[model samples]
Target: MLGAPGPSPAEEPPGGGAASALSGLTTRGRSFLAAGFAAAVCSYVLGQADLLRVGLLLAVLPLVCVAVLRRTRYRVAGSRRLAPARVPAASETRVHLRVDNVSRMPTGLLMLQDRVPYVLGPRPRFVLDRVEPGGRREVSYRVRSDLRGRYPLGPLQLRLTDPFGMCELTRAFSSHDTLTVVPRVEPLPPVRLSGEATGYGEGRQRSPAHAGDDDVIPRGYRHGDDLRRIHWRSTARYGELMVRREEQPQKALCTVLLDTRRSAYRGAGPDSAFEWAVSAAASVSAHMLERGFQVRLLTDTGSSVPGPDGGGGLSGGGFDGAASLDTAGLLLDTLAVVDHSAEPGLSRAYDVLRGGQEGLLVGVFGELDAEQTGVVARMRHRSGAAVAFVLDPAAWSREGPADAGESEGGLRLLRENGWTVVPVAAGASLPELWRAAGDHRAAAGAPRGGAAAGHDHERA
Candidate 1:
């Protein structure tokens, strides 16, 4: 069989070597030994030499097989590879395993089994015939999970059996590999994020300090400095050949905050409000990053992506030189294993946001009490454009009807604080909600900026 059933727990050997080989005897081998002993006893009682000789041969054959198999030195190695090691939740990823036999002698029957988490699926097993010296055999299987998290796949177990099926030994490779099942990232529609235009957008205005004829900042001239670029005023002020510095446009900044306090959300499994918030955070982060925005992800505990300055929050140049795909992968990988916090409130996230300059803030929140509401409301002032997606407690859980009033009250408080609020319920369409947020910003007379129009024209 190509993919044989795994060994039963009772059939597994406890250890390797001669003792284990003897303990690994098959039913046939044990029956032969038992029958041989009985025959020998009957022959001795009847004084029959011929019967004794046949019994001895039968008994010794199984012993010889065990001794030979135990003495056989088989050097084998195993390696595992996960194609697309990082995958979105509810998606399949293939895992390939290779077994190499380095011993000079041809190997016996090989049974290969890989350990896998129950959530991902059952462990996969395969059977292969003899492999010649320096030969390798490869096998692959698919695994998937509905929930998002990190799972390990590895420590391949190989069962080597004697040609006669008289004995077997199990050996396991020590190395392991990890598979990251990230949250499903939904593609969001373009919407104007209300924020000060400090990036390379149509609405962006040069700083007043750099507006006039002396817009350039002068620096000490370097060896390759162009003489025409030298600033006369700076040269006259004790500066040796000061040349004007070339300035580069800055990228827009976006902060995505996710509420992870266990008490803030309801239900469980993949459909929980908490999970929805996580997915939303991932989608928003990816969307902003694709638009050439320096995006930072914050949770109730703290910042997930460290800034250029090595702090918990992102600095202006945090994402310098990073490709959008790489940053998106980093963000998604972080969000993949994010779980609810036992501690209450969003104080850590608030502190992280406070440390940064005014920018665009997108928050995905669950049920918030008056204290948490006030905390989040105060955060709006730090961002030029602030948008929040609040989950309806009642929709998240049938037992959470009492929290409906709290959710309504929080939304009202946020809207009064000049935040564009979108109420999210179970099964709500995120794309539609995103468009509604854009409409709300438009109705509020927020300027038409680059983020709202998409980055197509800007890229061109």
Candidate 2:
């Protein structure tokens, strides 16, 4: 989403003077003025014509330049464009600026500066010699940021000066635009969910004896029912038009539960273990959405992440004037701004998911306590298949590794109860983590096993 540009450099208090409204003389101009005034005053006191002439000349030059600058007209328009408007984190993006002289007169050398996020790169500056009426000048620069978020790109600043360089004028174009940096989505090799192996699929199921709910389960074919979804075998047996309902099944649905509790994660800023959790969640959500599963991203607070239109939920809003919501983009956008919650968010997440069962439950979490571990264990039991990417806060500690036994015990609990758990450390390879999760799918269905079936318990 785009936000308004902040107050420009030229903006000042209402009753400000001309000096405050515009740039004053350069150092050289001030130096000349001081020397001229000293010489002029000395010449008058000593009655020396040579010193008087020199002082007058020096002083007059700057005044002439200022007078000329006062009459100079500045009528120009500028526009900025960002190439590949959307990009993965840490990738380079191109920013181009075009300035056109719209006035009748030609302008002299002008300075252009474009402000960008500090993480993207240094602020870009350029020089244009001249631009005649209807003339255009173009400037281009590249920016890349390691973090994912929506950043404003423009509100170009232009510095105009007269030929003598005595007086300067600064104008700011308040036009603003945004650059969206989405999280990196790593592709996982084909992995079969445990429920898929257990024969839970999209095949027809026996309808309830009462009737089918129109908003949810499918019922017998009515007059306007589409024939394509008709279940011929059920129709033959019941001697009625048995149409397959389009209700979402536990097997066809996947929920990405993200732990965003501030108290649970360690370290700080974008490089913390919390960020790694966000990246992992984004990658898994994207992969599942691309695989055609009905995926939803839920925070530990039990609230769905805001979608493209700034609304919550998968079916709530669309972005970029899209006719339908783009699930992958929405998930990434939500992850871009996710912050740690003050309270224990996992409890609320468990409360939300407790009423309904899920197909595949993939959780990206930080260190959990005993009560939180029990909640996750209950969730695992309700889901057909469950996978957990657990971040070890001890790995983020600089005071050497703290006691990991508690965290280990939590992971042990999840694994003992048929949860595929992968311990994640800071800066761990996401593809490897995904592979580990895939390798342990068998363990998710195993009645009793170690933390993972075949994979070793490698931290990070």
Candidate 3:
């Protein structure tokens, strides 16, 4: 069924609706033939030979016309396109159909069979009214997408037949049309992403490794000021352009560390622990980009989702697929390909990235060993990157302390080092979590509140 189907359509119409058409035709054709034959019989019985001959010739003319038309071997043609152009999940889109009759003779009936993509269309069959020769017609139909990803439309088919129902012929059209249906994505309103690492652009300002603060903009070098950045030409022109000293904008970077270990992904419905990590990453990236920071993507899964075709992504900022690709699609694709295992590949990737240039590092994960905790703690204290672990309560089968499987100890270690820590959970709102984390990172350098830290914290 995925490829072309065999069989030139049935000589007779082939569908549930075909039965009615057959019945209607049988009754009408039989009536016409019987009336014509009765008139001929009357003329012959009355011994009017010439009149009877003329009647016979007139009666059989239409049957000969149908035979001739069928032998000529003409074809039917049509085109199809999906509209609104790009279709997203849960949204309705239309399909445009334009049909044309390419034969010299008119077609009274057309049994069209259009191939729809997976799960669309009322049925596989289409019923087209009479089409005039060399004439065109267009029509539209609506369809809804229940899932995400790409869909291809193709192969228009038309079955043509002549009037009087004496003979039938089938004509199939050849053309390919395709459309991609993306996943439904919610809008991002706030700038902060929870359960993500904070680099130079949290509430507090940070300087780049390669460059220090512009330090101060001259309000206008007073006679008593240091002559380090004096603009003599400006003083000669406006008496003083008054170069205002402002805090230099720090170059910032952020990376999302996701937890794809089987042990970490456990969560109840609407509480997928993995989802918390993705949403947190999206929120953080959006927020950081708005604040003029260079953002990078990192994941904690054994093998992170690679950029399309193993190609590295563009640097610094500007929405990648984040704008064109729905957030759900982004996360779902990540989840679909995530390898559920504990691979130290994450640590190696981190080291390679850090070796290039020292910047803030945000760590996202579910389980951390003593050594892993120390590494994250050292990264925050020594390199200025904080790690936030999205904990899920549903991970452990046993019930003990409410904080039994929590990452409180590791969080505390990062906090003491002046690195901000943000925890998230399903019970809280993403916006509220962001505000709380933003406030805490601003006021206390860490938010004590939780947003999506629970292991199984699932739901969108």
lDDT of 2 by residue, 1-460 (tens): 0111234223223444455323457666667787889899999999999999999888877666665665676567788888988888879889989887877888887899988889888899999998998788998999998888899986788877777777665567777778888777787766766653225332121111122234454368889888898989888988988888775422145678889888878787567788778878888877765554556678888876543111223321111223124666667777877777987647777776776544577898887889989888888766767888887776775545556777778889998887889888667898888877876775444634564643455653
- Model 2 lDDT, full chain set: 0.71
Instruction: Give the Cα error of residue 65 in candidate 2, in Å.
Output: 2.4
**Where does candidate 3 stray beyond 4 Å?**
1-79, 84-89, 100-108, 111-125, 155-185, 188-252, 260-263, 266-293, 301-345, 356-407, 410-419, 446-460
What tens digits encode model 1's per-residue C-alpha lDDT throughout 47-129? 99999998998888788878887677777767778998999989999999887776788889999899999999898999989
> Which is superior by TM-score, 1 or 3?
1
All candidates: TM-score: 0.86, 0.77, 0.53
Which 10-residue window in model 2 sums to the lowest lDDT? 202-211
Q: Scored by CA lDDT, what does every candidate get?
A: 0.76, 0.71, 0.51
- Put down candidate 3 lDDT per residue, 1-460, tens digits, no spaces: 0112233222323452334333333344545555667769988799888767766765665445444544544445566767775665567888888776676766676676666776665535667777777776777777776544456665666655556564344444445665555433334444343223243243332333323334353466666555655666666776864544444544444444565556555553223555555445555544555544445455543233234211133223333334223432344444423445666534654454445434445555655655666655555533444546445444432332245444677667767865566665544465565566556655653333344344336552
TM-score rank, highest first? 1, 2, 3
Candidate number that wins on lDDT, 2 or 3? 2
Ranking by lDDT: 1, 2, 3
On lDDT, the leading prediction is 1
Count backbone overlaps in model 2.
Answer: 1
Candidate 1 global lDDT:
0.76
